[model samples]
Target: MSRVTLAQWQMLAAVVEHGGFSRAAEAVHKSPSTLNHAVHKLEEQLGVAVLEPVGRQVRLTEAGELLLRRARQLLENADALEDVASRLAEGLEAEIVLAIDQIFPPDALARSLDAFSEAFPHVRVQLHETVLHGGVEMLEDGQVDLLVSGLSARGFLGEPLVTVRFIAVAHPEHALHRLDRELDLRDLEQHRQLVVRDSAQRQSLDSGWLKAEQRWTVSHLDTSIGMLERNLGFAWVPETRIRPALEAGRLKPLPLTAGGVREIPLQIIHRDQDRAGPATRAMAEQLRTSVAACAGTRNFENIE
Candidate 1:
């Protein structure tokens, strides 16, 4: 079929919404006659009767319904394209959609956001907190502009940016605190390891010790923290995630084996189809810098 005319699509969409040519035409500032003629032209082009007059208002025929759906999509896409082009011409400024993993600290989030706002004051930024099963694929699909995902089993073709550490943590009053800073696997195994439920992102833990003990299994990272507080079980949580607690003497680090260590590397991921928009690229770089600042640069060598 021939491509839809912009005028006809506009007339069709307007009529569908307004239920009358006179109203639609007035809304679009076109003469009622002109709008009526445009719809007729569309019907002739499609070789189908498009509009059917109801008792007082008008409704779409089968072809009209289909055309209306397609017309709305086309007009929406056109508007998006036009806006992108306009933003590009003015400067590297457009609405940015960024996704961040929930593990990152909310306070640190402000610093990265501040940098973006200061750099691109004109551009709008929308931030979403994505946990596992989050919008990481959205970045790959171009539904999201950028994502702040940590290293995982699969590669996103992203650059090696930041490195994180997993530490053996327990409540201060727990039996493990009597030991030194250097943690051994035996001590970790002695206590039940409170693992977070449904969080596959941190599945790289070496739980040989826990399996030996056959201890209790709990859910929720925070709940695990609570369990640790109540001397329920020992947990190996991300160092970056529980750093404050460890420092405040609320939680104590029990020495664990270096071999069981795991590192989470943060990266910027974008789609092949997406031409990295300026706003997106800028924010992605800022995230890279922020993540690196929190954790050191990727130390893949240390990871076993």
Candidate 2:
């Protein structure tokens, strides 16, 4: 079998992208005959007809389409390789993938990302907003460079970023709020509880006082909050997220006799601190600073 060259793949990809060999040649700064011959040689080497002539323009055959898809991926990988090499040569990171838990304060996350953008304009950031164990899973699976989550990841030390207070809340006119005396477990169990399902694939877990007889499970924290706002059910939502609603009389904390507010400790976990690049370390520092700026009395701790 003849080995296919990258130059041939590039010519084929260019032809498909520009809709014809002539246009591709013009775009890539090559003559039309050169691109045409390159694609023809590629087809001969692969022992298949890659392009078919229509009325005016040419189209990719079935085999051509399959090869084109793989060719595009290869070209992208090659580009990424070059980008990484260039960044490394310049002592900078090409990209940073960050996975953050949904419970993390939005203002803090936004502030951190804003700082990151300003600090490292050339570095590309891939943000993944996860829930529950999703962030930890991403960290463990090597899918993210850094993780900010409430769940503690095994085999990795984490630094406490902030403490999120979860308040059991419901609409002002909800039955739970209309109760005469302080609410208890029995009262909550009678009402429908809106719970956010853990976004873990392997071992999904539930959290925060889910003892309700009737429960409405959702995928996102916003969905659960929306349900609470509509008086459809009660949920334990982050205090920061419901502050405006609480002040506006749209949502009120359930006056539970025992447990009303639950404080969750969130932490920043990295797969390997030593292996992290300069951009990753800088972004981590920015995230810590952002959380500290918002955290009033919450103390930051490092697990080592």
Candidate 3:
């Protein structure tokens, strides 16, 4: 009861989602022993069992189910109050600075800013373009109130509005492009693969992605697309970015999801307890909806 905080609940939920001590540990980057101890400590305090072990797997108990819902509500309310308190202490007049990941498109932002400006034009909105791989770094620096960015490596939240599929891509004539099924990351070992060095690429491509004899790491997704169009090398990219190309028959996606290939996630982030004022709140709402519009999912699922 006394030690039951938002953190324990987070670990509890992670344990539930992942279904085992080891997997949940990996998901939250905590050790199994640590997670086990914390969960037991929480259960002891609450005087209700939280997990039921079933042949090396763990599922939530009845008490765990009840506590999960209550824990989530508490975490959310605590975050909201923190946001509110910070804004009041700051006089609600502090400018809101936001960092946009370089990979973030201007079109997505145009609509969001339109809604924000229409509602609160006087709240100074300072925008900065973050370089690739810097989304979380910028947030950690406190340089941005919110980050409208692509998938980050780790530590940042994995709030996905859109599931931007990652698939093997190539020009019309490349040997790999003719496949009907999407190519996975491992398939690149045999072909000339071009990989981008941006946030999207970093999120999708890793050591497990490929072991190709010839690989190129370009600075931009478009550049990789350009090389693909030239029949130079195959690469992985967001399907959304190449939807036009696929529609035009200029490129094709190899069918697959094996290897380390995965959809690039988009996230909106502010400090844990940092509250938004009228202007910031208005802008945050618009930003959230705008991301959902781009992503085609109304993900008001996790809004911390």
Candidate 4:
């Protein structure tokens, strides 16, 4: 049972922020006397002189500085609570489930998420990092509100997001580079290849495996990249994912006569676009905006 009220603290803050009751009253559409009485009552309830006369304009006392500083935080939280309540009344979604492919640009994904959280601070996000058809599976099962994938869903239409380039690369010290000649599919088949396993539980794909003599399959692209960096094997990895490694000379691209690179266009699909709430729609918009913004900073080759 507290004696002070949020409205009273709000009045005190208005007075302090405006430097006097007269200005704060005008700013808040309240009379100066009403603002004065609220501040006086607040100080009396707290048993402290929160404001002191400094000849003309009043200033916060030592106790007032600390008390009002804490009260500002409470005020901000109360406003945020009210905002959430209003959004809920307007049918804002409480949570958004998003399934994105592993090949998507990480920078664009991070930027979109940061922007989404800033706009909808209360909405919860469940991010599923899928590979190949995994995102499409989630959309098919109605497990996610939004899906970003290189594969299209059977019944749903998607908007073109971006084109990702995959390059065949191996560590600079790998044995394939020692041959000093342009390698072909036959040369690569003799050595080991690292592949990322499809993440889907059912209807999984083995799209990129080259049927090498020795092959290693892992569940995540990060593991494949790690294996490539350690000179374990070669794989066709996303250019965005391996850009740093390429720039650092830790990995070298294979000098194949042809078919050394592949382009996969990604898409944004909603589980049910007509039924999507505000948060879901906003998340989709942010993803598109992020991809457009990130595209200008990088350059990719058009190797056939």
Worst 10 residues of 3 by lDDT: 295-304
What tens digits encode model 1's per-residue C-alpha lDDT throughout 66-163?
A: 86887788898888777667778955656878776655544356768888888776688887665443545556445567666673414456665555
Clashes of each: 4, 0, 8, 0
Cα-based lDDT for every prediction: 0.66, 0.85, 0.68, 0.92
* C-alpha TM-scores of all predictions: 0.52, 0.69, 0.53, 0.94
Which candidate has the highest lDDT of all? 4
**Which parts of model 1 are misplaced by more than 4 Å?**
1-94, 105-108, 121-124, 131-135, 140-142, 152-155, 178-190, 197-232, 257-261, 272-274, 292-304
Write down the RMSD of candidate 1 (Cα, Å): 11.5
Over 1-304, each residue of candidate 2 has an lDDT whose tens digit, in order, gives: 4388888899988888888988999999999999999998898888999899887789999999998998889888888778767868877887999998888888788889999888776689999888888888888899998999888999999988888888888999999878857988888889898888888888788786467899888998888888888999998888888888887899998888778878888899888899888899999999988887766622222211
How does residue 181 of candidate 2 score in lDDT? 71
CA shift of 182, model 4, Å = 2.0
lDDT of 1: 0.66
Better of 1 and 4 by lDDT: 4
Model 3 CA RMSD to the hidden true structure, in angstroms = 21.1
lDDT of the structure predicted as candidate 3: 0.68
Q: Candidate 3, clashing residue pairs?
A: 1-45, 83-275, 181-254, 181-255, 182-254, 182-255, 182-256, 183-254
